[model samples]
Target: MPATTVLRPRSRTLIIAATVPLALAALLADDVRVRRQLDAVPPDPTSSRTDSTTLVPASS
Candidate 1:
Protein backbone atom coordinates (compact mmCIF):
# COMPACT_ATOMS: atom_id res chain seq x y z
CA MET A 1 0.00 0.00 0.00
CA PRO A 2 1.22 3.57 -0.84
CA ALA A 3 1.00 6.37 1.66
CA THR A 4 -0.66 9.64 0.68
CA THR A 5 0.38 13.07 1.93
CA VAL A 6 -2.02 15.97 2.24
CA LEU A 7 -1.22 19.68 2.59
CA ARG A 8 -2.69 21.62 5.47
CA PRO A 9 -4.57 24.90 4.93
CA ARG A 10 -1.73 26.92 6.44
CA SER A 11 0.81 25.24 4.16
CA ARG A 12 -1.30 25.90 1.09
CA THR A 13 -1.74 29.54 2.05
CA LEU A 14 1.98 29.98 2.59
CA ILE A 15 2.80 28.44 -0.78
CA ILE A 16 0.38 30.79 -2.56
CA ALA A 17 1.66 33.83 -0.63
CA ALA A 18 5.27 33.06 -1.59
CA THR A 19 4.46 32.84 -5.32
CA VAL A 20 2.61 36.18 -5.65
CA PRO A 21 5.67 38.41 -5.22
CA LEU A 22 7.77 36.28 -7.60
CA ALA A 23 5.10 36.51 -10.29
CA LEU A 24 4.77 40.30 -9.86
CA ALA A 25 8.56 40.79 -10.04
CA ALA A 26 8.78 38.76 -13.25
CA LEU A 27 5.99 40.85 -14.87
CA LEU A 28 7.60 44.15 -13.81
CA ALA A 29 11.00 43.10 -15.22
CA ASP A 30 9.50 42.14 -18.58
CA ASP A 31 7.60 45.43 -18.81
CA VAL A 32 10.74 47.48 -18.15
CA ARG A 33 12.74 45.51 -20.75
CA VAL A 34 10.11 46.06 -23.45
CA ARG A 35 9.81 49.77 -22.65
CA ARG A 36 13.59 50.24 -22.89
CA GLN A 37 13.73 48.48 -26.27
CA LEU A 38 10.90 50.61 -27.62
CA ASP A 39 12.59 53.81 -26.41
CA ALA A 40 15.79 52.93 -28.31
CA VAL A 41 14.07 53.10 -31.75
CA PRO A 42 13.93 56.36 -33.71
CA PRO A 43 10.69 57.73 -35.18
CA ASP A 44 10.20 57.79 -39.01
CA PRO A 45 10.41 61.24 -40.63
CA THR A 46 8.05 60.54 -43.57
CA SER A 47 5.21 59.21 -41.48
CA SER A 48 3.68 62.68 -41.13
CA ARG A 49 3.35 63.24 -44.92
CA THR A 50 -0.30 63.60 -46.05
CA ASP A 51 -1.87 62.42 -49.31
CA SER A 52 -3.03 65.23 -51.69
CA THR A 53 -4.95 63.17 -54.31
CA THR A 54 -8.40 64.43 -55.42
CA LEU A 55 -11.23 61.86 -55.67
CA VAL A 56 -14.09 64.04 -57.12
CA PRO A 57 -15.77 63.04 -60.44
CA ALA A 58 -16.01 65.66 -63.29
CA SER A 59 -19.61 66.62 -64.25
CA SER A 60 -20.55 67.27 -67.93
Candidate 2:
Protein backbone atom coordinates (compact mmCIF):
# COMPACT_ATOMS: atom_id res chain seq x y z
CA MET A 1 0.00 0.00 0.00
CA PRO A 2 1.19 3.50 -0.80
CA ALA A 3 1.90 5.86 2.07
CA THR A 4 -0.69 8.60 2.53
CA THR A 5 0.64 12.12 1.92
CA VAL A 6 -1.04 15.26 3.17
CA LEU A 7 -2.04 17.83 0.62
CA ARG A 8 0.37 20.72 0.06
CA PRO A 9 -0.73 24.23 1.05
CA ARG A 10 -1.28 25.46 -2.53
CA SER A 11 -3.26 22.36 -3.54
CA ARG A 12 -5.43 22.57 -0.43
CA THR A 13 -6.01 26.24 -1.03
CA LEU A 14 -7.00 25.67 -4.64
CA ILE A 15 -9.38 22.84 -3.69
CA ILE A 16 -11.14 24.93 -1.04
CA ALA A 17 -11.25 27.94 -3.34
CA ALA A 18 -12.94 25.88 -6.06
CA THR A 19 -15.32 23.86 -3.89
CA VAL A 20 -16.59 26.43 -1.40
CA PRO A 21 -18.17 28.68 -4.00
CA LEU A 22 -19.87 25.70 -5.68
CA ALA A 23 -21.18 24.43 -2.33
CA LEU A 24 -22.53 27.82 -1.36
CA ALA A 25 -24.13 28.34 -4.76
CA ALA A 26 -25.81 24.93 -4.62
CA LEU A 27 -27.18 25.67 -1.14
CA LEU A 28 -28.53 29.03 -2.27
CA ALA A 29 -30.14 27.47 -5.32
CA ASP A 30 -31.84 24.78 -3.27
CA ASP A 31 -33.20 27.41 -0.89
CA VAL A 32 -34.57 29.37 -3.80
CA ARG A 33 -36.28 26.28 -5.24
CA VAL A 34 -37.89 25.37 -1.90
CA ARG A 35 -39.14 28.89 -1.43
CA ARG A 36 -40.64 28.88 -4.89
CA GLN A 37 -42.39 25.57 -4.28
CA LEU A 38 -43.79 26.81 -0.98
CA ASP A 39 -45.02 29.99 -2.55
CA ALA A 40 -46.64 28.11 -5.43
CA VAL A 41 -48.56 25.70 -3.21
CA PRO A 42 -52.03 26.67 -2.10
CA PRO A 43 -52.77 26.10 1.56
CA ASP A 44 -55.12 23.22 2.31
CA PRO A 45 -57.50 23.74 5.19
CA THR A 46 -58.04 19.97 5.66
CA SER A 47 -54.34 19.49 6.35
CA SER A 48 -54.62 21.61 9.48
CA ARG A 49 -56.38 18.88 11.44
CA THR A 50 -56.08 15.11 12.01
CA ASP A 51 -59.10 12.96 12.91
CA SER A 52 -57.39 9.57 13.32
CA THR A 53 -58.36 7.63 16.45
CA THR A 54 -56.31 4.70 17.80
CA LEU A 55 -58.74 3.51 20.51
CA VAL A 56 -60.01 -0.11 20.36
CA PRO A 57 -63.00 -0.53 22.63
CA ALA A 58 -63.76 -3.99 24.08
CA SER A 59 -66.58 -5.79 22.25
CA SER A 60 -69.55 -6.42 24.46
Candidate 3:
Protein backbone atom coordinates (compact mmCIF):
# COMPACT_ATOMS: atom_id res chain seq x y z
CA MET A 1 0.00 0.00 0.00
CA PRO A 2 1.26 3.49 -0.87
CA ALA A 3 0.08 4.84 2.53
CA THR A 4 2.53 2.60 4.38
CA THR A 5 5.12 2.59 1.57
CA VAL A 6 5.24 6.41 1.47
CA LEU A 7 6.09 6.59 5.17
CA ARG A 8 9.34 4.68 4.64
CA PRO A 9 11.98 7.41 4.16
CA ARG A 10 14.54 5.02 2.69
CA SER A 11 12.51 4.39 -0.51
CA ARG A 12 12.77 7.77 -2.26
CA THR A 13 11.19 6.56 -5.54
CA LEU A 14 8.12 5.18 -3.79
CA ILE A 15 7.67 8.41 -1.84
CA ILE A 16 8.00 10.59 -4.93
CA ALA A 17 5.67 8.43 -7.03
CA ALA A 18 2.97 8.32 -4.34
CA THR A 19 3.09 12.08 -3.75
CA VAL A 20 2.92 13.02 -7.48
CA PRO A 21 -0.88 12.87 -7.58
CA LEU A 22 -1.13 15.04 -4.47
CA ALA A 23 1.15 17.65 -6.04
CA LEU A 24 -0.73 17.63 -9.38
CA ALA A 25 -4.08 17.96 -7.57
CA ALA A 26 -2.76 20.97 -5.66
CA LEU A 27 -1.57 22.58 -8.91
CA LEU A 28 -4.90 21.92 -10.67
CA ALA A 29 -6.85 23.36 -7.74
CA ASP A 30 -4.75 26.52 -7.76
CA ASP A 31 -5.20 26.91 -11.53
CA VAL A 32 -8.99 26.55 -11.19
CA ARG A 33 -9.04 29.15 -8.38
CA VAL A 34 -7.05 31.64 -10.50
CA ARG A 35 -9.28 31.12 -13.55
CA ARG A 36 -12.45 31.67 -11.48
CA GLN A 37 -10.99 34.85 -9.97
CA LEU A 38 -10.04 36.16 -13.44
CA ASP A 39 -13.59 35.56 -14.74
CA ALA A 40 -15.15 37.48 -11.79
CA VAL A 41 -16.87 40.87 -12.43
CA PRO A 42 -15.19 44.07 -11.24
CA PRO A 43 -16.94 46.26 -8.66
CA ASP A 44 -18.81 49.37 -9.85
CA PRO A 45 -16.93 52.63 -9.20
CA THR A 46 -20.07 54.83 -9.29
CA SER A 47 -21.84 53.23 -6.30
CA SER A 48 -23.45 55.65 -3.79
CA ARG A 49 -21.95 53.95 -0.66
CA THR A 50 -19.08 56.49 -0.41
CA ASP A 51 -16.13 54.52 1.04
CA SER A 52 -12.95 56.65 0.97
CA THR A 53 -10.74 53.58 0.73
CA THR A 54 -12.17 52.89 -2.79
CA LEU A 55 -10.64 55.80 -4.66
CA VAL A 56 -11.59 56.58 -8.28
CA PRO A 57 -8.71 57.16 -10.67
CA ALA A 58 -8.35 60.61 -12.29
CA SER A 59 -7.75 60.99 -16.08
CA SER A 60 -4.82 63.34 -15.44
Pick the TM-score winner.
2
Off by over 4 Å in 2: 1-3, 46-60
lDDT for 16 in candidate 1 is 91
Query: Model 1: per-residue lDDT, tens digit, 1-60?
Result: 345667889999999999999999999999999888876767657765243233455698
Best lDDT goes to which candidate?
2
Candidates 2 and 3 compared: the better one by TM-score is 2
**Candidate 2's residue-wise lDDT over 14-39, tens digit each?**
99999999999999999999888876
The regions of model 3 sitting more than 4 angstroms off are 1-10, 43-60
lDDT assessment of candidate 3: 0.76
Structural similarity to truth (TM-score) of each candidate: 0.64, 0.65, 0.49
- What TM-score does structure 2 among the candidates reach? 0.65
Pairwise TM-score winner, candidates 1 and 2: 2
What is candidate 2's CA lDDT for residue 32?
A: 100
lDDT of 3 by residue, 9-58 (tens): 66777888889999999999999998788658465588764653567877
TM-score of 3: 0.49
Question: Among all windows of ten consecutive residues in candidate 2, which has the lowest summed lDDT?
Answer: 48-57
